[model samples]
Target: MVRLTPAQLWRFVKRFEARVLIGLVLATGALWTFLNLAEEMSEGEIDAVDRRLILMLRNPADPSDPIGSRNVEEAVRDITALGGTALVVVITVVSVLAFLFHKKRIHALVMAGAVLAAWASSDLSKMLYGRPRPDLVPHEAYVYSASFPSGHSTMSTAAFLTLAMLVASLEPRRRSKALAYVLAALVVVGVGFSRVYLGVHWPSDVLGGWCLGALWALVGWIVLRALHAPTRGS
Candidate 1:
């Protein structure tokens, strides 16, 4: 087994951090490009698009529906199930496990902090947007919160992506890391789509959720990496 010396680990982290920073910047630029384009569209155009999408998602029976019919009940059940809430619960469990079971205080703190920051950002955005959930469909499941961005989508992206990233970091083989990434993408997309299918959020709402979620996850990841890295001159 090859154990990296403290200096070697620190140097590796520096290189990793620089690469991550560059990736994060590029992602932010892409998100800004999307939002700018969205902002540039005429109000009428935007409204027309939103209305059409909402009607298709929420009022599936509308004659012009493009996405086709879906069983809202099943979608509601799936969206509101374990996976939707798993991020928060799992993060708590992992933090406890890392601290108590694994006896790694720093690692536990890093995970706990990252997860909590994501949760806080999601909650804040929900409050700020205060957008109403879709009323076109008979809400088979119940929720009473603002819905500009689906919390499920936001939290799922934050949690699943972060964990997958951690797994990717720990795994040596590229194949294993790629598998973890694919699985993570599936979970994030699945959860986000479930929100729309269940008539709980607008498509734009989910898009915003993904954007904010990814941004915050990147921020959290950077913080975690810095905290986890070996100290200088140790």
Candidate 2:
């Protein structure tokens, strides 16, 4: 049996890790480009697909009627609340405080900054697009903001995914890291879907939000990793 030297092992590990990071960077870039293209094409117009998808959740006979029963509507509202501004703020604050308590100041700061950036970006996009919320069906949830990009979708994706990345970084086991990412993906998808089901956001709006939010989260993760890297003199 041949034994590999420390230098050889280190080089192999570095190559593997680099490949993973490069993949993430490419995925983020691709999503951002796709979002820009979508915005350019659909800028003052609602696509037929977006209109049909939103309407599918409504009764054909009565456009105002939500497809589900009262219980389902209530359940959807509760799910949507998970991505609401109030809840996202609370979760981000609690996570930051916990990170600070553990003396991980960099992580805490990155998480807070990422979420704030996501919120600001969402607002700016809404202002730039000035797209109105869906009026085809009565909204199942309260909304007062312009709806080009779903704030709930963006904020929830940024917050949950940022937290997931932080947690996954701390896990020494690969399986644990995978689970963290899986849970993050579930939360992001669920929150985005809730917006459409509630009849307050078009499907395209949610897609744009998801793309933006995921890009933000990945950028934050990259920044945090760079910040935490060891100095050469050390």
Could you tell me every candidate's TM-score relative to the true structure? 0.73, 0.84
Model 1 C-alpha lDDT per residue in residues 97-188, reported as the tens digit of each score? 85446454554555566566667876786775566776665554567888756677767777767666665655678888889789878878
Top candidate, metric lDDT: 2
Candidate 2 local distance difference test against the native: 0.81
Q: Looking at model 1, which ten-residue stretch has the lowest summed lDDT? A: 36-45
Candidate 2 regions off by >4 Å? 1-24, 27-31, 37-46, 229-234
After TM-score superposition, the amount by which residue 138's alpha carbon in candidate 1 deviates from its true location, in angstroms, is 2.1
- 37-65 in candidate 2: lDDT tens per residue? 46663564557778889888888998888
Off by over 4 Å in 1: 1-17, 30-45, 57-76, 79-83, 95-107, 227-234
Cα lDDT, all candidates: 0.63, 0.81
Cα TM-score of candidate 2: 0.84
- Which residue pairs collide, candidate 1? none
Go through the candidates in order and give the clash count of each.
0, 0
